[model samples]
Target: MLFASDLDQTLIYSHRSLTPSSKADPILPVERLDNRDVSFMTQNALKLLQELSGQILFVPVTTRTILQYSRVNLQGYGICPRYAVTSNGGTVIQEGCEDKAWKEQVLAGNVNCADVRDLLSKFREISHPSWVLKESDKLADDLFYYCIVDREKMPYSELDDFALWAGKLRWTLSIQGRKLYLIPYHVSKKSAILYLQEKEGLSTLAAAGDSLLDLELLQQADAAFAPSHGELFLQYQMGVFTAKRINNQGIQFTRTSGIGAAEEILRHVLKMLD
Candidate 1:
């Protein structure tokens, strides 16, 4: 079985403290979003994640640059995922290590690297806001990409407009929680997971997430879920895909969300195999 989830608000909270600072309080994972205090995950969600590790392969997909991703401390989830997709599909990291083969494949798929770089640079020059603090390349172990701007000063509306315009260029524009990332449109979380499946056969699959970057991954799963806060929930309301909410209560509810409404999704997969 294969289980995949986005990391930021999906797995570990943003602030991500290892243990509670004060015992009397709820063990919420702290979220450092928009430079404000926000809770990332509930205590119950953490426990359910721990138990699910045994039933399926756990994969984390996130847009976080490899350096920014390393700062996170994931301790109590009980099990470590074997495959992690990072940079929105630019890289696929092996559990407890890094993998270079995926990036090579992605890069090879696109032949016009120089043209892509030139177009991206021009986009930054014309559309970027004046408050741009810094624009820099995010160098992975094997992949190279750039982030648009720092959220501390840029407004969401401006970013949205930039994204809308950027899309016409045939480049992928993604706003993941905070950072605005532009990547090749062909890159996607689902393709990365497929790469994993090709290498190691998948018996079952489940996925959870809260954003557009997750759209492709959700499509790849037998069962899929999103928190009430996820924008994808709105998309689901428009009759897009199959997903249900698990409460903020933590494990018991998450398991119910996964195995209950999503159980039939699993059964569907079993039937397909049979």
Candidate 2:
């Protein structure tokens, strides 16, 4: 069996996502950058994760580049996953080394999409300094790019039109929090998980995530979960999003939100395994 999970906002959370009710829970920092904690998990969640990792092939899948993913130190908390999917599945790592074959495959899959340079140029043309933060534009390992924007000032109509334009070019536009991402159609967590499943000869798969990017991953899993927070949950709650079912079961959601949601997700996964 294999369990693939998205890191940010699904398993680990930033300080801002923690609710007032969860502030009192014992939490441990899982990600640190420049002497500051960037992400964390509750103590109980950590324990459940440690137990889960021991019983299955746990894979941490994320849109983060390899360097950014390194900031998360699961080994320090007694949970070390042998395989990880990074760069939104554009890169896969095995035992701390990049799988060159997988990298080449992802690159080959993206050959038909618009070049990263072209996408960057187009973004610069359409974006304004007032909404897009200065010096916040970033290219992720040459596979995709994003910008931090002032959400309140964001022009929804322009964004919607841009999304349609990008979609025509085989690129996807996703907005999560203050970050807006433009990624290729081929680079996805679902594809990478499938690759891992075949390589490891895993029979059963379970997944958890909380964004539009994770839609395919969750849809493909035998059993899947999403926290009752983040993009997907909010859209579902507002009836704007409908999740596709797998074997007649749609993605399950945790009852709680914030840090408490992390514990709930882990417990559910553990129960499914049991």
Candidate 3:
């Protein structure tokens, strides 16, 4: 089996970073080790991950920049996903290698290269706000599209405005963490999964995530898992309705109990497989 999981608040806690805050409560323990900040992970979940590492192909599907994502050392946890997909499917990496095919596909799909830049620039100018911060060049060697303002600087309302403006260009905006991304409608996590399918000849996959950007990926998977927080607020504010809403969002559980959630989902998956 091929398994893809998201990082950030899904697999990592906000406090585990060099900076800790109130948001760390539900997911991290108050007890601090000497100088090391700890994040929460269920023991059972970790055990399952260790087991899965041997029997299945594990992939990390996260919105983190390649740089930030690399900082995570999964090796110490006794798990290593040989194939990691990041930048919200903008790049697919071999655990310890570099490749550019993913970026190339993105460029070929564009009939008007300059058009994307122009649209993003215009959106910035028209909707720029004091709250909107840097609009970094999302372009990379093998990236399919660009992203806009970093999340911390972007206010919710302005992001909403940007999304509306993007609609005019037939583009889509997905907010993951503090980053607001501008991607082509045709470019998506599903497309990346399809590419993996072609290359690996995999027949089934399991995916996990916790934001609006993850919805398509979740829907495309043979089995899926969604964390208990984050973008669920936006989903509800938009009056979106789904069959289930656990923990006040899609799934509800203690953040500190991440392993428990992972185990629960995995057990269900294993049962289906059996």
Candidate 4:
């Protein structure tokens, strides 16, 4: 079996997610992000991940760049997952090293995509220097571009327009919290998962996430789930998204979020094992 999951805001959460800090148990910071911000996951969630890692292929799928992805401390008392799909599937890490074949495949597959440079140019045209935090601006190995935006100072209409413009160019744009990503249609978590699944000869897939980027991954999985508080959930309720696979039966969304959501999904996966 193959188990794929998104990281940020799915399995891992921010300090703000530790609800009612006065009453909640003390939490430990696992991921040290830039700007001194730290991300957390419950001890219960980590323990479950350790158990799951031993039972099946556990793949960390995310849009994070390699550098950012490495900062996450998923280490525990188990072997690290041999594969991670990073840069939104532009990079496939296997056994602690990138599988070069996958990188070449992604590049060649996106050969027809709009130039990454054009995305940078378009951002410059639409951005206000003061609103776009330059320190976080980065190009993911020349495959995609992302930067932290001051959302309060930025208008939603501008981002909406940019998304439409990028779509016309065969590129896709998505906003997650303060970070904005402009990625090509061909570079995807689903593509990487399919490639890895075939390579490993895995028969079943279970996936979970909470964003547009993860929708395809969930829909493609044999069994899938999402939280009730994200882009996916909003669209799901609106009938714009669907992932009730004929092969699987269960609760579609976790009862809570952050660590609660992670643990709920892990428990659900444990049941799927039977």
Candidate 5:
């Protein structure tokens, strides 16, 4: 069996999303940058993850660029996954090395989509300095671009219109927390997970994620999960997102949020395996 999971806000969380509670378990830093802790997981969740990795093909899937993903040290926690999907599946890694074939395949698949440069230009044309952080606008590995914006000040109508326009050009726009992403339709976690499934001859698949970007993966998986604190969960609660089949049978949601959700997800997956 192969288990694919999103990294940020799914498995590991930043300090802001740790969501401390009186009854919460002790936490451990899973990612550090520049001598500071950047991401963490509950001590119980860390143990669950370590145990899960030992039992199945655990793949860390994320939209983070290769450099950004490198900042996470799962190995230091004794949970080294052999495969990782990064850049929203624009790049795949195996045994700590980029899978050149997969990278070429992703680029080939993106040939007919709108160019990244064009998308970037469109974003700048629609975005405002007051809400969009200038320094945080970045092109991720030439596959896609994103900007950190003040969500409270975001122009929702403008973003909705942009999403429709981007959709016509085979692109997708997703907002996760402060970051807004413009990605090609071809660059998806589902596609990469499928590729790994076929290459590794893994028959059964399970997935977990907390963003719109993960919708496809969750839909395609035999079993899936999303945390209560994620974007998808919030959307569901707002009646903006729905997947009747998956929601009723294939996908499960944790009762808890933050690091506790991570533990719940891992434990559920392990139970399914058993």
Candidate 6:
């Protein structure tokens, strides 16, 4: 089976999302930035990931820019996922290098780049520098635009308005913590996985994530899961796509959230496929 997963919050997690433990040696750090550890998973979760890496094709699907994604060190854990969908599907990585032709196709054909650019400019014009970290704002390889924001200061109404504006422009807005994303409809994690499926003839697929960006991927997968602590979970409670969880098909919810949920989903996948 080919496993497509979101990195942050699903498998890897920042300290903020990690469960506070009284016992030491409970979790292992998996990602670093600026010589400091940032993302982690439970020790058991790390072991499961290593075993899963050996058992199947693993692909990390993320909204992170390639540079940011590269900061994650999976090499030591026997988890060398050569194929990664980065920039939220703006670029595909093969052995740590971008597949230029595929990237070009994604930019020119898949994403309506011109329309996205026009919309991005308008967002920039309206975004207040107080909340929108303008310096962190970047147009990701022309496929999407995103910025880190001061979430506490950013008004919810503004975000809701932006989401509507994005929809009108055939784009999607995703707010994962401080990182706010404006992505074109076509440049998506699900589309990227479908491209891989068509090329590699992958049949059985499993996926895990805890964000709106992952909804399409989850719905399309043979077996998919979401943690109890994400936008989708709230949506599910509000009767959005509740049948998946109710029917035990397509998508399901995990008992835990954050890194704890990471291990739970992996165990579920192994059990299902076995």
**TM-scores, each model vs. reference:** 0.67, 0.96, 0.72, 0.88, 0.95, 0.88
Which numbered prediction scores highest in TM-score against the true structure? Answer: 2
Question: What tens-digit string does per-residue lDDT give for candidate 6 at 1-274?
Answer: 8899998878888878754551254877788878889888788987888888888888999988888898888887778986999887777898878888777777576444347657877776668889988588888766777789988888788678877877876778888767888887878898888887776788888888888788888888888988888777777788866536323585778877666788899999888768
Q: Write the per-residue lDDT of candidate 4 for residues 245-264, one digit (tens) a residue.
A: 55555327887755578888
Question: What would the per-residue lDDT of candidate 3 be over residues 106-155, giving only the tens digit for each residue?
Answer: 66766533367676677667445454455554554334344445455556
Taking all chains together, the TM-score of candidate 2 against the true structure is: 0.96
Ranking by TM-score: 2, 5, 6, 4, 3, 1
* TM-score-best of 2 and 3: 2
Residue-wise C-alpha lDDT for candidate 5, range 1-274, written one tens digit per residue: 9999999989998888855481376888888898999998888888898999998999999999999999999899899899999999999999989999998898787777888777767777779999998788888998888889999999889889989988988999988888999889889999999999999999989999999899889988889989987788988889886754444664688998877888899999999888
Q: What stretches of model 5 exceed 4 Å from their correct place?
A: 22-24, 245-248
> What's the lDDT for residue 135 in model 3?
56
Candidate 1 residues lying further than 4 Å off, grouped into runs, are: 15-25, 28-40, 75-77, 112-114, 131-169, 176-178, 234-274
Say which prediction, candidate 4 or candidate 5, comes out ahead on lDDT. 5
Ten-residue segment with the worst summed lDDT in candidate 3? 245-254
**Candidate 6: which stretches are off by over 4 Å?**
22-25, 110-116, 150-165, 240-250
Better of 1 and 6 by lDDT: 6
Better of 1 and 4 by TM-score: 4
Global CA lDDT computed for model 6: 0.80
Candidate 3: residue 187 Cα off by (Å): 3.6
Question: Which candidate do you rate higher for lDDT, 5 or 6?
Answer: 5
For candidate 5, which ten residues in a row score worst on lDDT? 242-251
* Candidates ranked, most accurate by lDDT first: 2, 5, 4, 6, 3, 1
Look at candidate 3 and give me any clashing residue pairs. 27-256, 42-259, 103-142, 151-178, 246-251, 246-252, 247-252
Best by lDDT: 2
**How many steric clashes between backbone atoms does each model show?**
5, 0, 7, 0, 0, 0
- For model 6, give the 10-residue run with minimal summed lDDT: 241-250
